[model samples]
Target: MMASQRGDVSAVRALFVSQRASPYDVTPSNCGPLRFAIESGSLELVQFLCHNGADVNTTFGTFETSPLEWAYKTRQIEIARFFLRQGARLDYLCFRGWTPVVLLFQESSPTVPLEFFGLLSGHSFSDFDVQDRFGVTALHRAARWGSVGDVHALLQLGASPTLTDNEQRWTAAFWAASANNVATLKRLTEGAPSNFIDHVDFRGWSILHVAIEAGGLETMCLVLELGVDPHQTIMVESEDSCVMEELTATEFARTKGQATYRCFTQALQLTGYNISVIEDSDTELVFWDT
Candidate 1:
């Protein structure tokens, strides 16, 4: 393990060849030399370990990830590709619904390379929409991180922007709004019509509502321009009962502060909305509508 972590390929080879060590030898943590080699970022050591019969699919660490996943998490694209070529499962979901495709977007820098997506796709099952345990697809991950290029690549690779995560059913637009990433949101809604920008999450929060809650004044204005009503409300349902709470966009803005409220009101006027109707105290609603 030490020699592998340090990229001492000859020592590793000698150990295996002299029968003094098993290529499968693992630490108390179940981590083998291949995992170390991947962490070391040495492709030569990785190749040597694999040639000497290291398990490409070995699951280790807290996430119980495969060697390919470690390579990805460590940003070793070449090593990851080598594992894929050695028959690592691209669709394999480790802890938290992480697959090679999801990892490529989630762990990669915003400066995504086209070749990375292409490589993963070539080895994948053509299911770009595969979600993790949390139901987060490649699109959701990319959009949440504001990686526009990754979003484009995933969409071109057949990933659906409408797919939601398991926890909140957050769509690509929803995730972008949650992160206050107007750039990603614009890219996502480029060809989308006005109605398409009105997409809501599991809580019934529209993109405008989410943007306001995210405290992005610019994004709020952008959504209004895209045609989301300023008076839009998000319905929150409690698990204990069937009762629902309607939280208006204005209310969300007000809670943010006087400045946010001013921005919200101004955005409404700029979009040609009747600001008075939204501000009417009689229209005020509580968390519990009962």
Candidate 2:
């Protein structure tokens, strides 16, 4: 395990040749030798382990993570592709019920290629929408952080935008909105019904409301242009007193600050709604001649 982690191909080979260690041996943390090789970020070391009977499909660790998942987690795109070519399972669920595809999007760097998704042709439409423990699907992950190309690829591969997470019952569209990904949100709802955009969460917070509070000015404008009700209200519970209050999207934006409030009102106005703008007296001081 130490040799593999250090990328010492010669020492690892010596261990194998001498029959002193098995390629399948796992550390106390349940990480197999293959995982250690992957952590070293050396394709040569990884290939050596696999050639010596390392189980590419074997899931170790508490999360039940596979070698393919490790490859993705480490940003080894070539290794991931190699694992795919070696027939690694794409739909296997790991920690927190995250599938290999879902975990790929969870990565924060090295944007995944659209061609990479093409390798996962064995899965059915339902397989792409497989949810995690929180009912968060690959589409939800893609919508949140993956590129527009990533979202499109998932959609083409049968991921549904309508699937909702367990906690907020937030659809992929909602995730897109909260992430301020206007392009992704637009693409996700391109041909969808008006009710889809206007659909509210468990707290009665619509996509418009989410855009107003968590999204940017452009996102808020886009939601309004998409026919989301500007006057829609949500019942929010206060964290301190647990007080439930119903507030419209505009009113909710006010709590976010003047800039957000102004953005929402301007969006409403552009969409031909009659929203009266309230002046902030605190922002202006009277100048009197003394």
Candidate 3:
């Protein structure tokens, strides 16, 4: 990105023209002129970095965060596009996180530029298969960060909100409501399958548990209107999900490794809206959020 930022044609030319037969290491710590230029929004420098052997996918630090993450967090869509053009990988899996796409969703962010969207539209992010250390998905990231635009973009680009992380876990809907994103929640619920209302995690957490933790009335109402169980259990059942226990031939294709999906409907039938009893019962409803 720095190389692109710098707009140094020579630098760009030099990077791709490596004489060595091997690839140059562009780790974040070792990044030079390109990193500096990218951080400073020097498109010329970023161009140079991409042209040279500066990695479009380079993570500046060993923290697993990448320059692309920085670009998204800063809403520097131009810089992000430059990297994408240079072949940076978008969408990560089997990891904790690549960068902070969530920051893009915040209400506090500046108006995102159209160039970023154009670039994003042109590329296919690998978020569908990407997972974080906790088995969280890019959808989870969008939900946690409340980046509905990003979520919509990802969905439009073929990401599955139904996918589970490494843990076979939460849906994008769960995370969205947890982060108090009413719009995201509405979209998720309105478009989800019938069983989603009863979906529970291994710990048996319906999306409502997550939403109450966030404590927004609109979020709660949105979730409620969508029909999640007010009395859903948080403790995951220590058995295979009933949804997938049937014969393989009968089972339609599902997100790999996800025993859990949206089932708030079942959970609601199991536990009606009775927060007071849960608030009073010490052991029976001990998992209740205080």
The best candidate by lDDT is 2
RMSD of 1: 5.1
Per-residue lDDT tens digits for candidate 3, residues 86-135, read 66776641134543444344445544454555565567444443555666
How much is the lDDT of residue 174 in candidate 3? Answer: 77
Better of 1 and 2 by lDDT: 2
The residue-level lDDT of candidate 1 at 59 comes to 84
Q: List ranges where model 3 is wrong by over 4 Å.
A: 1-29, 48-59, 64-73, 84-114, 124-129, 166-168, 231-290
For model 2, the superposed segments whose C-alpha errors exceed 4 Å read 18-20, 84-87, 122-126, 238-242, 280-290
Tens-digit per-residue lDDT, 145-220, candidate 1? 8377777777778777777777876788888887877778878888765468666676777788777778776777
lDDT of 1: 0.75
Q: Highest TM-score: which candidate?
A: 2
Decoy 1 TM-score against native: 0.81
lDDT of each: 0.75, 0.78, 0.55
Q: Pick the winner on lDDT between candidates 1 and 3.
A: 1
Model 2 over residues 1-290: C-alpha lDDT tens digits? 88988989999999989999989787888988888888888888888888889878999888889888777667677777778767787767787787667767764654677655765554331478888888999888888887888888888887888888999999998998898988788889887765786678887888888888773878888888888876677887765689988876766887788787777767766766754554566552212222
Each model's total of backbone clashes: 4, 0, 58
TM match of model 2 to true structure: 0.86
- Where does candidate 1 stray beyond 4 Å? 10-21, 193-195, 235-247, 269-290
